[model samples]
Target chain A: MPRPNLAPPDAAPLREALRGIRFLLRRGGATVADTLTLDALPDPAAGLAKRMIREVEGLARSVDEAASAAAKGVLGGHDNPAEKLDEIVGHSSAAAEFGRAIYTALDAVLRRIGVDDAFISEMSARAVFAAWRQDHPHGQPQDWAADLTLRLLAARVIRGAVPAGSGSIGRVEPVAVFAVLLWLQSDRSESENEAVLEAAADIALARATEIAATIGSGDQGRIAALYRKYVDHV
Target chain B: MSKVRLTPDGLPPTNEPLRVAVRRLRWFKAAFLKHAEEMGAELGSRFEVDDTKLAAAFTRWLDAIELQRPADKSQRRAFFEFAAALMMRELTVDMPLKAVGEPSRAQTGSAAAFWPEGYCCTLFCLSVHAAATAQEFHADTTIDPAIDDLRHWWSFKENTIRDASFSAGFLQMLLGSQPNWVMPDVFRAKPRG
Candidate 1:
């Protein structure tokens, strides 16, 4: 894909967001699921979200049975089962409402550091093209992954806006916050004075990139590089 | 067009520009149930949710997890596949649903008891989304924040499902009923290699 021209001022935050996919590959999901921060929510807020999180297992079961009955109805030539499936899958305004609540909390984290959720694509296209450009200065099909992987490794050493202790890292799937922290770390060589953070980021970003290749696709080559340079080395 | 309007005048259409209000699986389930129950309360239990609309919505949300973020198509597919894996939580392995006509009518069961139904909802949403959009569903889409309603909207879902009709409507179907699908003669296959 062709990328839009973007410089560090506009591209810095966008560049920082490059690690979100790495979260999908890690065990970060369980952390997000378990960390709802329900008490932190305002009163009379997020009832469905509470119920959904509190009783995730039950809701999954109910949704399962419902899907079966609906399938049976259609196969049996029954009239209403399809409607049932339809409702569960699509038309729940209440679900959208409360889902928005949970979404807002996670979104705030991204916005806090100036990463606009809407423009992740622009950032990625730039990364992909940049990856392509590094190997092919003349520029064509080449070792794009190697260049991209090097970039990812470099990203880990830079400082970012997300505080590692935000625990908000647990709020999102696969830990986008983890990726943000990974891509934007304190320059280890420079911040070696902050002993704890350097060690913490090393382990965290390493783990963050550990399964990023497995969980993420297309960039597996580069992600493999991420794993080798970070996790395997650690 | 159908007789009764499944949604109100101002609501978004199933094919509205792609948007995923939340990416987390737990949130997805809650949001889905909340929407279904609210319709039961306000639209009347007899009201039928438009399947295309429903499928389109879920499809947008799920697929966007991959589609909107990845610059390359392969990563996009991989991202969504990972998202799907997350959905397959510790669901009961054995879905010993009775024969289609005589499905076992119990709500409280394990993934063995419920996954078939859950899979049906997810697969159907994916299909409908792909069919209508020719698998180009993610183009020009966005996963914008759905924060406006967090503080107060959930109350409606809680309160709405209280009515007998609402209580017995979609929620009941999920817990105890089964639906089926028959292939149409001329169906659009999603453009996959």
Candidate 2:
């Protein structure tokens, strides 16, 4: 795979992202599932789902901020005009709506947990990917992480492990994940990063397996316990 | 050709595509199971759904299709496309789509024509962006462009782009571009022998 032609003007943000990722790497356990007990997962899961909704809203705002900051930097908004213009336009309406679907699923999970929010705002995006990578001891061959997440979510829904509303997202089987991974692996520009993603996908699968096992035991009575344990602070 | 729509567990015509889908999905299941076996990952006996079971799943859907039961058009399409793409994707795994160029249907302003590009471009953009995001950790690595290479576009008919690799790339790119995006590391492709 080829690399991105250009680099972000400031490495600070990227560096900060790395530090946050490291922190997540050292932390063990599926934090989301840990936050709620089995019986209470629906409610809290719904809350976390809602948090994703809010997260998307917040993200839109952040994109605006990043645009503004980039505009103010060296170019005074004149740097790669075409690209800058693209950024200014920001995320599309369709994309925002898709975010809603993702949030809806999260919301369903929250409902089962019996809460309105999990408040994992401090959780960095990089960290999530890192933890995913750590989860895979074997090399990840393709984009299996997303597939694993999708599979677990879908299976949970199908089995009635998650709230009823959660089933709408549907099943994202391993084949789907593999196809995308195969596509990415095909790109010359990104060939180097293939191993990294493969690792992430592998870990994602392993983690999903763990989560499924936990849930398979029929509501480990853990989600509710976590809710009572942490809801007060939030 | 009469458009015979299918239900989840409908009977499928012993035709090219449906048979292909079942055969390919079975292969996928086997491959995944093999991976599980190698890792000693415990594809638990209970969790294990063998080729026989998977074939049963496909057969059930094919049977439903033949019965003319109400079926999910979207899901049926998804199942068909998944099988198609997996076959093509695997066939050309090591080959760059750019090296191959656009497929015939893509040349005639067909929907599938843009699929290769749409899929490859979106995936390329996301992969590069994601890799760039992770550049600090793993230095001196090139990402895969097969997902975005334009060559694969030539393989499909005009109406297949949506079913092409485009949707996958678009979704992942959307995920990557989000402000509060929780980047899934799976977007990164691992090196294979």
Candidate 3:
């Protein structure tokens, strides 16, 4: 028996469609996650759930747009759009799998936070995007890790974990967290200046983590003890 | 303004053009005289007066200015300031003045007036002016200056020349050289040592 040819007759349109889908998913996921994480949610678990739902919805919308464009291209007798349509249709199962994974993660996080709600009400993509737009009026994407670090700090404040007037963590605290995240994320080609920033971040992170642990235990004295280790660092 | 003509051989004219002379004299009175007085006060007996050599250097510089023929009022003023600065350096910094001779009227010029060796004087003069201008513009008297900060500022403006020089000879002299210059920051904090 002769081996069947694996190559599709028209591959260019399918490639274009896949490229568009990849860009849409990456940018959409990052934007949604950053937006939801930074917004003033009732709880951290709720924010993470909202972010997951919005990301899936965003991916689905992009897939629909791609399908529509491919159908129009086929009808107009343009470069073979049926090939692209088929590729997108074939990926529908994968998209569904991504949505299931997001739901599973949300469930796990909510359970850890002592929320056992079986059904999580999904938020509309428009609502989440609108909140993001309102927060960033200039339409610039929020730096995700920096926003996450700040939200974590704000969460600690909201929980009354740290004393209100202690003045232990000041404005520089967020910068320190951002630096550590950047340093960890950096590759081997990092410059000496960046290495210095990373080292400083390490020092700051050590102090911050200690403070966070103390706050978690609800021990004000321990929090003070950890903060005193680096009173002169900042 | 008179239309100053360059010699057919491209050697500077033996006589200074009337417009250049007037500009040079004004610069001498306005900036040179004031700076000379300050130098006299600073280095009382050590400041030596070489009247002939000084006049000769002034004329050579004026010829250089005339050859360059700055396009507008601003450029003309800049040249005048540069000339004044050059004279100030010549008087105070002990820069050897270039000797000027009578113009070679012959098509084949006399050897002495053809190519003068005081091109270094021009480079030193321009460098000093650059240092002075950088000092005037960037020197923050309000903040307590640090030695590191001052060194950074100086290094930043090391190669910058404020006025244009027509002579390749002068630019060649300045190509790789760094001048030892200082700005007086009276309010500077004492160094850590």
Candidate 4:
């Protein structure tokens, strides 16, 4: 007879197992709240427990920033914010180009809404811009590039409208709409800008507010074509 | 079947993990077939998963081995096939690698004629290892292994997305598990009384 090769489930890394251990010590009469305190663990495990607690506390700050970004209409609107940004921006042909396009589209959409340069500059000096500045120092900030790409994409998606009864938290509409329209006339499909035109109309209808601009027949394809770039970038 | 609307709201939630959930998709079967076929080119008596039908492939394979009631065989096998497909590239049989710990009482029944514990152990390890290693955070290469990473991530997301669909406390209940878990039925220990 052969022995069945059995094994126990591998323990998570010492660091990880240390991360999940919660000992309820009734000796001190402490509640679940203090289960993570160093006093709860024996001296052997105290150092590691304290380190784990600090690391967890650090997340509160990140979450705060992400929520702030989301309220300000940046890229924190998903469960996996950092990863989601990566997944979306990874589709871009180039970082500089995608970053440039998003900025342009955001500007155009804002102008279409009749906001001035001061507001636009004010917006740029905020969170996403801060991230870009920090990351862009050495070379291409691909992640921040993705973040910029995401903000405008959300704007575009929101402007196009979420499902009925679903709504976005911010106006975060458009700024570089003209920039988004760039290269639309560059030898792509004639109806390439149809999405932009349709989305613009949809935005108008959903808001029941008039757009400051009029659509031209010749510009329709061009606008739609540029939006296809949004699809590609997203 | 008619076209199924795939809105975010429409995706039905399930208790099964990715390894099990993927098998139900026709695309996964197609993908796994590619993995198995590519593996078949030079293999000899490998632990080949009988991918005849996506539904009962795991059950049939397990029945041949354990003769136990087929409760969650597909889910168990799906995990195996997933790991096998991933490990078949570089993972070989009978390396000096020894799995630690003894078999639980659940796995001790078939110790003789057809002991399938080794295969299950390898599959479980590979799948679990892949999962633990592949986590993503703010940093790409660097991993700050702590329960806080998930808390911060979840807190930020919940605040932003405001997913109203699930019942209250659903997210907390799910996230509260220290090492988030799945109910893979392969070599499952008996329920606590």
lDDT of 2 by residue, A1-234 (tens): 998799447443443334334324222123443554555547867778667755754655565456435533532321111111112124343222222222233333333233232211112322333344446524232233333334333333111122124322122222222222222222222332332223223322323333344333434243223212211111
TM-score of chain A of each: 0.21, 0.21, 0.20, 0.24
Tell me the TM-score of candidate 4's A chain.
0.24
Count residue pairs with overlapping backbones in model 2: 93
Model 1 chain A is weakest, by summed lDDT over 10 consecutive residues, at A77-86
Candidate 1 lDDT, A1-234, residue by residue in tens: 999997535323322233333222122334556666777777668676676664755554455455434433432211111121112223433222222222222243344323333212223333543443444433211222233334533333222323344333322223332332222222222222232222323233324434344334546455434433332111
Model 3 per-residue lDDT tens digits across residues A171-219:
3333333333233222222223232232334334334444345445644
Best by lDDT: 3
CAPRI-style grade of the A/B interface in model 4 = incorrect
For residues B40-104, could you state the per-residue lDDT of candidate 4 as single tens digits? 22121222443222212322222322432336755543233223222221122222122233333
Total clashes for model 1: 32
Accuracy of chain B in candidate 2 (TM-score): 0.20
- Give the lDDT of residue B9 in candidate 3: 24
Off by over 4 Å in 1: A1-109, A112-132, A137-150, A164-219, A222-234, B1-11, B14-193
Model 4: per-residue lDDT, tens digit, A1-234? 999999755221221222112111111222323565568678768878677656655554455444444433432111101122233344432333333333344434444444322122222223343454455433223323333434434333223211223332133332233223222212223233333322332233222211112122224333343333332221
Off by over 4 Å in 3: A1-234, B1-34, B72-193
Alpha-carbon RMSD to native, per candidate: 24.0, 24.4, 27.6, 28.7
Q: What DockQ class does candidate 3 belong to?
A: incorrect
